[model samples]
Target: MQGYSAASLKPIFDTHIKNDAQVLADGWCGYNPLKEECPNLKQTLSNKGKNFKMLHIQIRDFKNWLRGVHSYCNKEYLQKYIDEYFFRFNRRNHRKINFR
Candidate 1:
């Protein structure tokens, strides 16, 4: 979101995430307001990214891919790049069927 505040994240959370969906997040104060709406939301200390190794790895890999492939990207189209990267990453094991 534009900022890591409860106000900045609430709208996106309300629109895209179901109230009952299990939401896992770091212990950021920004998510405090969401608990009332999302009963299943859980927060834990990030422990300097060590608590979520795989997630951090994926983020790092995506950044590397963006730097290596695109070199630079316009902020306006950054979301499109992220969507495309995840789309391909999600289907990496099904390449044979992905084209069909």
Candidate 2:
């Protein structure tokens, strides 16, 4: 959502998403406009403890592993690290080296 525009979000709402897609996301203010824009939109508060427990378990685990490191240091490389981590998570331990 950082660089996305309202125009960009319209397509997602308009697309033939399966089963009235349940989008799980943090409470970003940009989505405020979506309530008026998308007729079927459902909003969930991500800060709720129970919801965070289920949704962010893996990301919390990753942060826990870096507990000893300074927060600012991790912030510097956060995007790259999260991308690589998610790639491995999706791969399920497969170690192929080909770049797609």
Candidate 3:
């Protein structure tokens, strides 16, 4: 995160987000080239009024879930854990239809 090189961020941003998706970020140099990388990217900067409130809440909830359920997850397995969390969260409302 300290370096703004595309090589360093490709794995996190390029791989996870689609080229047409808009990106929201703080006024950080790392995100400055988002529009350049993805021509359709609508980059937004939050100068005030809790720009990252939803993201912050999700991270906080994820941390709490990990701490409460797993006690302490290792860094190596954190991404997989996060992926599973997203999977379950995304399908939460489908459980009723799925079982019946």
Candidate 4:
């Protein structure tokens, strides 16, 4: 695993997010490379009101959803479970498009 190394973040920065987008992250050595990669990168210390608030909220919700709905997941199939959740989460606004 790359585990927060500069090498690990290169491709994600290169491919996933656009250069114009702002990259907000907590102060971690792993994210240090982002400064060089992104023009709008903002790395803040892990203090109150400094962290990415909504991102942290979403992460908390995901963990709660996993613990509450799945109870316990096997390591072998955890990726599948997370994928399923994202599938539902991504299309959550289209409840009555065709039906209505």
Candidate 5:
């Protein structure tokens, strides 16, 4: 986002996250406003990423994939690249299943 402010995050949360979905985030002030919009929002200290080990790993892997595979990305298409990566990542275990 342009900045980690509530205004910057609101649109993303509204577009991508369901209101009823449980959301976990670091105890950042930017996420405070989101609690009103998302009833299930939870905030806690990150403990230097230890509290979110798997999430950190996934982020690291995505960065590595971006650097290794694309080398560079256009700012305009960065979101599309992230979406594609997570689409595959989310379905990695279900590859044997047919979509149709």
Candidate 6:
């Protein structure tokens, strides 16, 4: 949600996330705004609240993957490219690519 405004998340969540799907995220303040924007959303932040619903999916995994592909990539592009990379990784024998 770095580059994305609260308004843009609707299409992304509706189209991509679907229902009954769990969302794992970090402690970024941007997600706070998303609470109102996404009604179905179950966001998790590392910094606030209790009984963390959001899985603290390691940024290192994604960052290393993105960094391996190309440096200077920020969170805006990171989500897209990481999804693409994970797709390829899942398809390629589950061996996966080393981003580092």
RMSD, every candidate, angstroms: 1.8, 5.4, 3.3, 2.2, 2.7, 6.8
How big is the positional error of residue 92 in model 4, measured in Å on the Cα after superposition? 1.2
How much lDDT does each candidate structure score? Answer: 0.92, 0.62, 0.75, 0.80, 0.92, 0.61
Candidate 6 C-alpha lDDT tens digits along 1-100: 4466655565686688756655665556655676554555555545543445322244456667677778777767767887887787567664544442
How close to the true structure is residue 81 of candidate 6, measured as C-alpha lDDT? 88
- The lDDT of model 5 is 0.92
Q: Write the per-residue lDDT of candidate 3 for residues 13-61, one digit (tens) a residue.
A: 7679888776665666665566677776554566453777788788888
List the pairs of residues colliding in candidate 2: none
- Predictions ranked by lDDT, top down? 1, 5, 4, 3, 2, 6
- Model 3 misses residue 93 by how many Å? 1.4
Over 14-74, each residue of candidate 1 has an lDDT whose tens digit, in order, gives: 7899999998899988899889999999999989998888899999999999999899999
RMSD of 1: 1.8
Model 3, TM vs. native: 0.69
lDDT of 2 at 37: 47
Candidate 1 at residue 91, lDDT? 94
Clashing pairs in 4: none
> What TM-score, over all chains together, does every model reach?
0.83, 0.51, 0.69, 0.81, 0.73, 0.42
Cα error of candidate 1 at position 24, Å = 1.2
Predicted structure 2, TM vs. truth: 0.51
What lDDT is obtained when candidate 4 is compared to the true structure? 0.80
lDDT of 4 by residue, 1-100 (tens): 4576878887888889898888877777877767775878887886874366777787788899999999999999999988988887887898687347
- Itemize residue pairs with steric clashes in candidate 6: none
| Candidate 3 colliding pairs | none
Name the best candidate (by lDDT).
Answer: 1
Over 4 Å off, model 3: 1-4, 11-16, 39-49
Model 1: residues >4 Å from true position, as ranges? Answer: none
